[model samples]
Target chain A: MMAADEQQLILRVKEGDHEAYRVLVGRHMKHAYNIAYGFLIDHDDAEDIAQESFVRIYESIQSFRGEASFNTWLYRIVTNLSLNKLRQRKNTNHRITNLPHQSAMNIISPPDDTSYQDVKPIIERALHALPTLQRAVVILRHLNGLSTKQVSEILRCSEGTIKTHLHRGMKKMKTQLTEIKDEVI
Target chain B: MSAHKQIQSQFYDYIQGGLKSDEHSIIDTHLASCTMCRCKLEELKRFIESPVFSPELPSDKLPPEYWNNFALEVEQKIRTYEIEKREYSLSLWDWLNSLFIFHKRQIIAVSSALTIVCMAITGWLLYVPTLVDEKIALPEISSSQFMEIDQKVGEYLHKSKTLLVGISNLDLEEKSPIDVTAEKKASRNLVQEARYLKNQPLDIRSARLIGDLERIQIELATIKDDAAIPRIEMLREGIHRGNLLFKIRMAESMYEMPRLMNVNNIYSGDRK
Candidate 1:
């Protein structure tokens, strides 16, 4: 049902129908919100950035070119804007400090369910310690399920560079998890 | 390769999808055969699939009013652009009015005055050419006289060649004929000079001459028998031909130097 609605919405929006724009905003809001949240890690900031991204998309509709799927382009814009905002916040020295080291055990696991609840916060703390660009690469590669080529296009970098970042990021995360495991033992 | 290094390299390639089908099959077979590698691959696959963090869904949902505020901001910016466009159009109209509407009489007066001045300048230009044609004259010279002058220049060049050959023979007689170091140095210099001359544009006649001279120099430098006087004489003839070619190319370069200098000046000016 959502796929059919999305196709219809895209056709209508391409024809310059304002009503179609509204439908698109409604349909994609959750996905856009999730991407923004992934980077900013703050609900309010994510919502604001997602809304602004939609507005910019509407104004620049003529510039879409349609070389990539609409969802890919929209997500790329939201991710870039969220990362830029994060960079600005870091520069202003207004970043949040002294947050507790969230463990990964709290995340819901698909297979073991029981182990997930204890590991989620640990995973989150380990992710936060990763360098920002590497963290972004990992999230886009794994969580978003984007191929290396797609991630490279969205990140405006070579596919090789993206692979290197992913490799290093995963290695670092593995090391961090091992350290956490030692502590637990 | 050692087993550990081979496994590490294969694991890296497998993860990257860079291995060929044959190599991939080899790795797969090894994994199936080896329990340790199979376990490592499984652990890596599970770790990558695991989530980094889990966040609670947002609770303070934005009311529909927020979107309305965003739409209003966009509308205001668009309206401002429209107003600026109108002001720009008005300024352009005022400038056109000053140039054409208010100054129509001045424009007509200037046009008639310019036409009379142009007619007077055209008459003077037409009359001056015939006057100069009648007064100026050019001298006549015969083609045979020009040819004689060219032959004299050739004779002078031939005399210079003979003088150069005499000087070279005297130098060779004075020096130790079998000194390997001197012969090597001379050959090296000849090679360097030949290479430099090759880079320059040479006529067919001159190029063949230089080629012959280079062959002579090479042979003379390599001579192991002092008794080879006939071979040395033949090499001398080759050297003379080569020297003649070099002289011809040098003369042509001298003629082109001024034009080359002008091009250099223009290039330097562009850099500045």
Candidate 2:
């Protein structure tokens, strides 16, 4: 939530208010975890990055000079930390295994929702297959529901570039999901 | 039809609500008439509207207890981090305290005498320097003055590049931190030089490059002897993000090319 209320929490946080810090962490932790999850499909890695991101922000909160909104700053940190994790994974030649399909389907509260169950892994794999920038644009733009302008700010690129990446990323996912559509039709 | 091509391009913008009303109507009309376009739009919508892109995390995926304790866990982590930092600083003091316990009186007497001698010398030195320093006037910087500054900046950039490359090429498996001591020392000197050049009258381009250089140089200079891999990786990321080495090389070439041309012209004149 890009509410002005965070400004007060941030000010209190800066003044060493532990209650304010707790409030701030509670408010943004899910968003941070979700963004990290968007980059890293693994829940454990996402949780780790999300927790570490908040810790980094707490340590360097003095440097957070309200230049951009707090959410934007948090998003940038989550995004960078997630990318670093991915890079580390790559350097170590580690592979993240996908959850078993039946178990993944079981996690959905309404197991009767067959469409989402069928397409969830497919969509996730397509997203994972994207180039880093395109995947980031799609995740921030679509998954996080940030505006293109916000995505551009977070990615530090022009809006045109964001649009191009978004367009390309969606097209790829759409192609991958075409089988589901044909089955439905 | 060319209309179909144009309409396809707007599908993303249409779904995003980013198109103007007129543009939106054009796509709507095209989709209504063309079954192919309608199906394509439907396909995009299906993918875009999938629960995978939802902002809300699927509740069942994570236990409720996890959310309940997330904030507390973050706070606990932060507390642990602060304690570790405090202990790191406290260790330095503890070392000094132990030394003082062993040689308390001798240390006190020596420190007291040294302070008195230092204060006396400081008083004499401050008194003498004011008179000698007051007569010196700041001179206007000529082009050649900045040219010299540019040369020094170029040298600084070269050295910085070498140090960064050295850091980059270091064996990641090396457990020892002392290997970076030389690089850190060189960065410290570059930081001093950067500060000096920053105060000088230089062109905007030179000034900006130096500003970026100063940031990374400070990071490099302050790298702890016990720095972890992540710390060094962060420094490398900063260099990559700013494209610092590339910019430095471009800046050096911009400054060097002119001087090289001038030297060439002088040699040609002498030959003539």
Candidate 3:
């Protein structure tokens, strides 16, 4: 949450006070990095995304009417930029991973002893399997625990679209994981 | 619609829990009696909870080093962007200064030349009206100077007669001491002058004289070397038949004598 005083700092930044911008960035840098990291799951990429998002925010701050607080606007920027980078990465290397043929097929069962580490690859595969919008919605709603309404706001999509993506994403993961769980049992 | 497809389609909306009361109750009653939809709703919960299935957003903090210079780095990027944006904009004064510095010698030379040309044009504009006024005043003053004009015309006619008499006496067939080529060229020039003089608004007798002079000059211009004897004989016969030489002498006397007598009378009256 942005402090009430942060709005004053935003005003100063709009007035060309660099120190005010620095303070605003200092306050929100951690939150921005976490959101980007949650999406990209990379430390260096997250940091880069955070920095770029701040630069974009600074450049377009004059047009920032405060209806959606500076944070949601910043979230939208970092999330959108990270999503683009993910799409570019997806396009470059479109091949599936080197799991066993059976695991790759559908079951996605963790090899022998099931642990979070063993399951991590399966979860990541399922998450990336989703279409880009669905993946964003799932990450924002399920992973980040944002409400469907908040996810819709971040994605600038209708609540119905967000809900549809969220439900479909979860359902696919459930079907896969249930099959794996049936194998483990 | 199949019962299964209807349940599957509304599964997303139903899971998000925003369905209206009537719609919710309808789906709820169907789910209560329908084993497949009930099982599907149960699967939705189990999947959201499973570690093997759910996406982890990795909210763990990044390393301390990552945040250390983070704000400074962003501000530096912002400052650099601002610098680049400013460097790209050239104000009018800066543009003019650059232009002046780039072509200093050419600009100075062109400006100096233009200044001199402008001064010349201004002088011409001012001086030209005076020249015009003088020209206008001149024709009016020279309006009463017709006696002088008539005398000048008489003198011009007297000069033209000398050229005419020379050509008529030069019997080209005999080809004597007269330089015939030079005399022919002179006569050609005299023809051009006579043509100009013929157009002058003058007494009918003078116009007729000029007209006769031009025709003789043209016949002289076309004189064939082999046919020279016959052409010259022909031309002289034509002139004698017209009695043009006698008419010219008589008109010159009549025109010049009156102007001279008038001037003499004026001088005499002034003396008395």
Residue-by-residue lDDT tens digits, candidate 1, B71-185? 4543455456557778899889988778777889887788789998998899989999887876443323366754543443333223333333532463345435533334434
Q: Please state the Cα-based DockQ of model 2 relative to the true two-chain complex.
A: 0.19
Per-residue lDDT, model 2, residue B83, is 98
**Candidate 1 CAPRI level:** incorrect
How many angstroms is residue A15 displaced in model 1 relative to the true structure, after the best TM-score fit?
4.8
Assess candidate 3 and give its TM-score to the true structure: 0.49
Off by over 4 Å in 3: A1-6, A17-23, A90-117, A175-185, B1-30, B53-55, B87-272
Runs with alpha carbons beyond 4 Å of true place in candidate 1: A1-15, A100-121, A157-164, A178-185, B1-27, B33-36, B46-272
lDDT of 3 by residue, A74-95 (tens): 8899899998877776799835
Least lDDT summed over 10 consecutive residues: which range in candidate 3 chain B? Answer: B263-272
DockQ, per model, reads 0.15, 0.19, 0.23
| Candidates arranged by lDDT, highest first | 2, 3, 1
lDDT of 3 by residue, B152-232 (tens): 556545645665665578656455433345445555766776776665456788888878877887887777666666776
After the best TM-score superposition of candidate 1, give how far the Cα of residue A165 lies from its true spot, in angstroms.
3.5
The lDDT of each candidate is 0.60, 0.77, 0.70
- Better candidate by DockQ, 2 or 3: 3
Q: What are the clashing pairs of model 3?
A: none
| Model 1 chain A: lowest-lDDT 10 consecutive positions | A100-109
